[model samples]
Target chain A: MKRFTAICLFLLSVVALATPAFALRISIVPDHGNPASPQMGDRLRFHTAIQNDGNAAQEGVLAWISLVETDSGKEQPVDLEDWSAHKAVVSAALLPGQTVESIWPMRLIKAGSYRVVVSAMSRSGETLTASPFVDFTVRQKPVVESSRIVPVALSAPLLIAGLLIWRLRENRARA
Target chain B: MNAVAVIARKEAGDLLRSPRGLSWLLAMAAALSAFSLLLISDAELSLLDNAEAVYGMCAVIMGLGALLAIVMGVDTVAGEKERGSLVPLLIAPVARDRILFGKLAGIAMVWAAMYLLALPYLWAAGGAGQNLAEGLVSLALLGTPVVLGFGFLAMGMGARLGSTRSALMVCLVILLLAASPVILGPSLRQTAVGRIFDWINPLSVALNALDAVIIDSQAVVSQWLHWNLTLLFSGITLWFARDGFYRTAL
Candidate 1:
């Protein structure tokens, strides 16, 4: 009976020792959960939720969205200054079992395959957590835009020049 | 017909159909075309926000219009004096004030035409995304008075100097001073002296109002102070121009 009691105590101690001191869980999704189609100059919104599963309150945790272009052999980090004005959100204090949600809006400036993720760092700077990468493709906008602009650009000056010539000739004839 | 109307019509026809005036308009169109094409086709420039592109076009249009105004204003009395036609104009049935009003009207007509010419380019750049219409309205509201203010100031100087070359030189110097805000960086514009200068500078006021309306998406009702500055500038110039005409020697 003493051995049985010792075994029960040992099992309980192992379970407590294996458990993490603090748990920070995060998940990110595009606005509609489908990142199938995006284009240059399109505004894309992302929704991220951060939840604290630990026993103590969380404070001073920093969360930000990161974007990386993953176009085959050309992988690089995208600068978010033009894409978004506000990129980071800091929580003053998050109680245990409480969840915080944030929305990030970005304007796509280039066309390429990209992966975006949300990362969070703990207040004590010990633990770092990141959500799963959300992969998406941003297609190049059509060339029709240039074609549409060319006619106006060409014709406006020509029309003015024509008017000027005609007016000049008319004035000479009158004189 | 009123003396003002008669002189205004003749002056408008004379300048609008003149070779030099048409050359100015043609130059403006060419510059606008080049800019619009670059904005649409260039990979990097195309990435700018649609509203920002519109604001750029607005600034360009305003600058071109002001240049044309200065040219025409300096030519109003001073050009005629150089050609030995001022005496005949002064001895005509029109009062001096009516002649000034007539000249102002003629400049207004050219300015209106220039404004109309800028519309298609504005639409091409900004019609797709946002704030194109608001930018246009704000431009007209701010651009008209600011442009006319420069015109009247140039005319007054032309009357006082009685030499188109001298007036043109002085007006160009003043224009450079007015446009200095464009050369200064954003941080520098926030300093005490810069703030005071921008508040009084009609061109800066117009550009700021355009930025607020187009980029910041602020409502036009919030831009009353900017409007007041442009109007005050115009009023002062008109008064100066009237006094200039009264003191001029035929």
Candidate 2:
């Protein structure tokens, strides 16, 4: 029984050591167009690279990008299905010491302070994640063009109607 | 008369006539078809990329099979008792054990038929060159215990509570328990606590079996262990169901 117990302990330790540890490093660089003054429906692009810093190669890496609204805590994911439509690009795998670039184009609908978060994972067998958040601002566009054209357009229709009505009244008085 | 055959025929007839049963079948078919189409499209893009992608595709198919088994099992017993026909059936000349076995056999038949119908579609979606015979075998083995485990739980609750709603809730909990490992395995990999959960989770075992068949093309021993545990659980639950039915006020 003592010998059996010793063997069990040895086997248990071996089983424990069999599982691997993964180390991953991720970072983001703002590319194409300024990070400042992003407009609604404008394509905002950023480059992200993920590297497997560990000694071993990892399999089944899933990566996606998300934009977080700083004030309201709302998040919008860069659409990967329409990657080119949204100007978003992604690579599913990266080798050890090898880096792959991912580009994301974001559309800022509502004017608010925002941060982008990029995340990566290796299947269920290992826990290697990189969540790097980048902060940026979207400045509101000036309404000067619409403001100038509105009063002139609005008054023109009213002025034409008043002139026609005044001519009718003057003709009636003359009659 | 052969008890299993008689019960199975009657039960299958009832299932065919039931709108809910037909709806379930239609729903599963639609969902599986949609998922299979998505995988096929993916496979077309990168045929020679990685063996893991093919395995992932098969996993999605097996996952759908497991979900269908849970839905069928949950309704097998509780649905019968709630319809007010269970009491008369219990009082019949047939042996109680045979009746219980018959119900399980009938539900198994329905699931098997569903699996068979879905297989060709899955094969077509997997593409012509993919080796899917081993994956199919693994899925069959893993699916048996899952179907029986959920069926037994539903029958046990049906015998005790005699309510379909309660049985559904119980089955949902069981489904969650069966599926939890796959969902939680990633986070649990780093800690001792997560390790314990992974070690005991049967879904991991089923997935591991799938990984072997589809990804590694290895033997089904690890998956067999999971099927065995599921069988053991089913046996225990069957005993509870038998005892509960015998003691009930019907």
**TM-scores of all predicted structures:** 0.69, 0.55
Predictions' DockQ, in order: 0.23, 0.01
Tens digit per residue, CA lDDT, model 2, B1-250: 6897789767665544444455555555556555444433442222322244445545554555556555555555666666777778878889877887787777677767666755655454433434467667777777566555556666677667767777677767866776666555557557896666555655566676677766676766645666776567667766776676666534
Rate residue B6 of model 2 by lDDT. 89
> Which residue pairs show backbone clashes in model 1?
none
Docking class of 1: incorrect
Residue pairs with backbone atoms closer than 3 Å in model 2 (clashes): none
CAPRI class assigned to model 2: incorrect
Candidate 1, B-chain TM: 0.95
DockQ: which candidate is best? 1
Kindly list the per-residue Cα lDDT of model 1 for residues B1-250, writing each as its tens digit. Answer: 8887877777667656777667777899999998888887765577776788889889889888888889888888888889999889898876787888988998888789889999988877787768889999999999999998999998999999999999999999998888888766567588899899888889999999999999899998799999989999999999987888778844
Best-fitting candidate, scored by lDDT? 1
